[model samples]
Target chain A: MIAELVLAMLFGLLLLGIHRKVIARIQRRPGPPVWQEILHAAKFSFKTTWVPATASGALFAGIVLVAVGIWTAAFFVMMTGGSLLIIFGIYMLHKIVEHAFGLSSGSPYGKFGGVRSVISAASEIPLFVSVAVIGLFTGSLELTEITAWEAVHGPLFFTAFPAVVAMYLVLLSKMPFGPFSIVESKELVSGYKTEHFGAWRAGLEVCNGLKTTVLLATFLLVFAGQLPVLWMVIGMILLTVSLSFACAVTPMLSPFDSVTIQSLVTALMLVYAGIVFTGVLP
Target chain B: MGSLGGIPLYVLEFGDELVYFSPYTITLFLLALTFTLLAIVSRPERQVDVAFGGDAYTTKIISVDEMRFRRFMAIACGLASMGAMVTGDVFNFTLFTAMVGITNVGIVAAVKSPHVQDAAYQYGLVALSATVPLFGAAALYAAATGSLSMIELAKGTLPAVPLVAKALLVIGVVGEGMAPFYAAKAEMFRAPGAPYVIMCSLSSLLIFLRVAEVVMIG
Candidate 1:
């Protein structure tokens, strides 16, 4: 599990680097190297991390630790074929971590970011629906069972494509450059991380990477099933390119617009779920 | 397990009339209890100060009477939530849910802001109205099974209760500010106190969780 987590972080950071490179190329600018995130983390680690005088000391100091811990647990659960219910629980807890990250800083920007996190709670339902859809087709909520089913019946992506779309949207909302990235947009002065600098910010960056890796890995696991190492890396790259393309083409939506889009996706998924539930869409 | 005063420490039974504690209830009970403790301990001192027509930076301290009342309400909310989770009787669950609603109002009632007070008033009305459906669901179950005990209901011996009754139970709990109803309580969070105010969210969440389990088991 520890090894998987460490590899997840490495791949996560690399994916982010790939995303930046792709976006920069599309925008006609020279971007940082694919290894830029590693360098960035190394630099931040050398700086002295300090809590701001105006911040809520305990909550402020605890956010990064909590974020890292939650994502690590998520990775562990996924790697071990543990309960998907537990993974869903971890995902919900991560929302609270975002709220805490913003609220703890006592900065207006952080507070707004925190409120945005709360507003974005609507996105959670679609993810839950996606889980239900997967459970329905696989006849189990355990990753082991789902993977075993896939081993016999093949990837669910062909049959459950709508759910795949919904889950992808959930992943998009969490990733940088996505429509929901407004929470940390430059206009908000980096939003929740406005106050957390140096090592703390680095911790958050690492957490972000881990979250990305977990989410993408989950998508692959459920939709594509288990693949050989070379094939998995190829799949990850293809996914990264597709997400980057979407990010490049789409403008950032207002929080209201983003929620509306998520709601529509959720509605579509629920309709699909109803069909499946009614035995009309075998 | 070990014994505490001649009663088993791990499981508690009271002839099935009062409450029963098993591994499931104990797990969720401890979860709610721990969050309540954390809510009390993690009280943030920065209070939101509202200004009517002038400077907003002027500092003001919460009055002792108001603080005492808010603390009392918060503790009451916590205890009521604990009761809702730990009780074996469906009627008692509904009763404690109603208390949770009342105390939710009490927790924010001390704030001297019109907007917040207005929201609290609205939430109170909605929450109070929820009791009809809540108690009605329990009553329907009792009528169907001749017993309101969840242990009995979970035995699967009685006729399956109507779906509407289950729907009523969920809707009543949702009135405690889950999802669509959350808009009514959103402004109440703007009240100055963080620790006491968090209890409002915590209690609602716990009740909703317990409702899910109860709905499933029963």
Candidate 2:
């Protein structure tokens, strides 16, 4: 488990660097080395990290720990091939962590970020719809069961392609620089993380990297299952690169716009899920 | 009528020695209990004396008396939510749902901002109107099945309910701020106290969860 966590964290940070490099290259600018995230972490570890005086002291500090804790648990779940429902639950709870991060800072920027986070939770509906679709297709919510089914029946994407797309969109919304990155957009002066500096910021970056890693890994295991370990890792990197390209091409949507788009997607996914649930598709 | 930690907790008086503790009720009860404890223990978002981006206002702080009252209302809301969750009878569930709405308004009514007061007023009016559908659903259920007890209905003692009653129940709960009706209560979150404001959202969520369980299981 410890090894899994360490590898996940490392890969997460590495993915983050890859994302930056991808976007930079897309703009024809020289990008930092792919290890830039590691360098940032090392630099921040040596610097002083202080709690803001204007902040809600306990909550401000606790939010980072909460983020770290939840993502760590998510990492554990992914590594152990635990129930996907548990993973989805943790993902839902991460919305609370995001809201807490913003609200605890007592800064208007943070509050805005928090509010955006709340609105973005509506995105969960579509994700839930996708989960239900996947569950219907596989006859289970357990990752092991889904993977086992995939091993015998081939990948679910071959049949439940719409659900795979829905899940992919949900993943896009979580990726850095994705259209729904309004929570930490530059317009909000880094938004929720505005007040979190130094080591706390480093902790958030690491958590973000872990979240990215877990999400990509989940996508691989859940949708593209039955691959060998070498192929699985390669598949994950390809996914990271594809997501980075998607992020680079798309501009961030306004907070309200993101919510609107998410809701529309959720409505569509719900319709698809309903059709599946009714046994109209099989 | 059951005992928890040696303290008798009244559920529904179905009859002598016929207590209801179904999995549906248990799930709602536990969810409410969890959020209630959270409302009590979670640290609130701090409202600072300073403002940024040239938007300046006097530092907003609730008086000790008002804070006490808000906390009381929040706890009351929590209790009402839990009540709505665990009730075995449809009428009692609707009654508790109405109480949850009332206490939800009361939780945020103490904030002095005109915006919050305006939002509370809007919510209060909606809550008042929502009771009609809520109680009407219960009445419809009773009239349709000759009983309002979910346990009795779940036992196949009653016929399946009219679709209208189910729809009404869901609409009534939604008007209490789930999704579409959430806009009415959005401004209420502007209230300076996080703990109290949180109850407004939490109660609605719990009630929604309970409603989903009730609709499917009952």
Q: Pick the DockQ winner.
A: 2
- How well does each candidate superpose onto the true structure, as a TM-score? 0.79, 0.78
Clashing pairs in 1: none
Clashes of each: 0, 0
Model 1 off-target regions past 4 Å? A39-42, A280-282, B1-37, B45-104, B135-162, B179-186, B195-218
- Per-residue lDDT tens digits for candidate 2, residues A113-174, read 76677677755543566876786687665677789999999988787888888888888888
User: How many steric overlaps does candidate 1 have?
Assistant: 0
Second chain alone, TM-score for each candidate = 0.83, 0.82
Candidate 1 residue-wise lDDT, B157-199, digit = tens = 8777666787799788877644222533456753455556556
Best candidate per TM-score, number? Answer: 1
Relative to the true interface, what fraction of contacts does candidate 1 keep? 0.01
* B1-218 per-residue lDDT for model 2 (tens digits): 11111112444474622335443345446545655665566545556544557667444556778777887888898899888766777788888888888888887777877887887888888888888898889899989988877666666657878868987998788666442124434567545666666566657766765575456434
Q: How well does candidate 1 reproduce the true complex, by DockQ? A: 0.15
